[model samples]
Target: MCSNYDSVTSPERLRIYFGVDAPAGSIKGEVWPLYQAPFIRRHPHADVGDDAVPPREAMAGLFGMLPHWAGEVAFGRRTYNARSETVAEKPSYRDAWRNGQHCVIPVEHIYEPDWRSGVAVPTRIQRKDGKPMGIAGLWASNRKATGEEVLSFTMLTINADDHGLFKNFHRPEDEKRMVVILRDDQYDEWLDAPADRSMAFMQQYPAQLLMATPEPQRGRRRTGASPTSK
Candidate 1:
């Protein structure tokens, strides 16, 4: 359900934050819903002098599934998130769950919403402490009709126990529950955890460290909002 996120993080910052050292200027955008970057994993060795982390080779993109994935390929509707709880039973994810694929999805922040007015008012979700947060994710390589190869991912979800970060997602029509929040020390385990332990890492939530900001609405008029002729 994490369809939008800020993919414009700096490579140095991303390296320090994710330890994979994405190539410079490789950050996607502020509201990314897909991974069509020509250089997806360009900087597999991004480094900012943080403690020794895992090698870039441990990272995997969605494309890894192609040239072999026999399932129907459709991304217009299929997304990245696979709830850890039922992954073992779901047709779209069960196979991947048991194999323990390694992946690292870098994100700066995400957009959630409040649909009280029957219209969604976007609320930007980030660390309450102003630090970036990484949501545990799974990626798959897909082939587009345009004949271009791409990678995409999804963020897992869970109930909002007390974070109040997304009570709006639980609305009657929403009924959304699942989330993917991880700690720095838990990254390795999350990226490589077995199906049994994946749940433990996916359920962290880390609400105490998260903060939400309502983005400002932009003026719609071509020139600008103006006083009516009196």
Candidate 2:
């Protein structure tokens, strides 16, 4: 599960890469559960018969998803990563999944644990080509008692038991998993896909296209260990 990640911070990057305009310094650099970050979705006007507006729009949202029944935003911590296999059946995610609330979470990199050496070492994983990844996700909106609207999202993850690179993370006894990183060309299709066809885009990203390195924790010294790529 991706509980932490680095979000794309530059508005120009968002406009050039994701084709959406966002104000500078609007998104946080690092994102954790409940942290506000930008996500891309099909513009509401597009579905309402507006032809002049852009098809896609970017908005700041909490990293974790909050269902309509959630009493507080803090519930996002456990809903940050929705398993692709059960998302449609899970109560917390079913509504968004059923409503075709598909979205893309722009990530600079994601952090996972490298338990290869018996100790859990923090590892940073990113595309080998150094491009921002648009991970497949679902977004939802909830209203607070004060009538304020809160938007949130969750990354969709798939089983990676046999994946070349991701199978090496986590512990030996745990079920391996990785986020569904969509190809650049699939961005529009993902947002427009129906629930029945969304699963087709949940395939794992190629191991050859990704690289991982040990990222020392705050105040920790850098290690001489070599980075890993399949």
Candidate 3:
């Protein structure tokens, strides 16, 4: 599962790659669960079968998904990633998957663990070409009692037990998996396709295009919050 990733691509970069309007806010660097990050999705009109308007745009959405029935954002902690094999059956993602709430999460790289040394060491994985990756994802929006709308999303992942690089990360006992990174040519079709056809875009990216290196975890920065508050 991809819980943490680098989202340092500037808004200008997104505009160029995705051919969509840039989000207003600055792009996040280290995007952790629950943090707001930019995601590319079909324009609202497209969802309603109106093709006269623009096709897609970029919006800031929370990293984790919040089912409409969920009372608070805390429920998102466990919904940050939805397994591709069962996303259509899982309560948290079934509706979105069926309703065609697909999105593309842009990231510079993703973090994983390397256990070859007998210990789990954090590793940074990115495309060998140094280009940003567009990970397939599902999104949902819920209105709060206070009349506020919350936009959230979850990255889709598939079993990577046979993947040359992905299978080396995480625990050996745990089912190996990796987020589905979409090819540049597949982005438009992925966002415009219907729910049933979305599954066809879940194939693993070629292992030859990826590279990984051990990266020591950085020290936590000090915050001004009091110890009691923390």
How well is each residue in 60-173 modelled by candidate 2, as lDDT tens digits? 988888887787887776788898888998998998999899999889999888899998887899999989999999999988622678888999999999998899888889
Stretches of candidate 1 off by over 4 Å are 23-27, 37-54, 57-76, 142-150, 161-163, 170-172, 216-230
lDDT of candidate 1 at residue 113, scale 0 to 100: 58
CA-only RMSD, every prediction: 9.0, 5.6, 5.0
Clashes of 3: 0
For candidate 3, write residues 1-230 as lDDT tens digits: 88778874586778777877767665577877777888889887856766666678888888888877777886677788888888888898999999989999888889887787788788899999978899999898977522578888989998899999999998778788899999999888888778889889889999999999888774232331111100
lDDT of each: 0.51, 0.84, 0.82
Model 3 segments more than 4 A misplaced: 46-53, 145-147, 219-230
Kindly provide the TM-score of model 2 when superposed on the true structure, using C-alpha atoms.
0.91
TM-score per prediction, in order, is 0.71, 0.91, 0.89
> Which stretch of 10 consecutive residues in model 2 shows the poorest summed lDDT?
221-230
Per-residue lDDT over 1-230 for candidate 1, one digit per residue giving the tens place of the 0 to 100 score: 55556652465666666655454324345533334321122123435554453444323233112222433444323444555666667555555556554355566677765576676667677776665666666544546433555444445555554455566543446455545777767666666567777666656565557777776362122431111100
Best by lDDT: 2
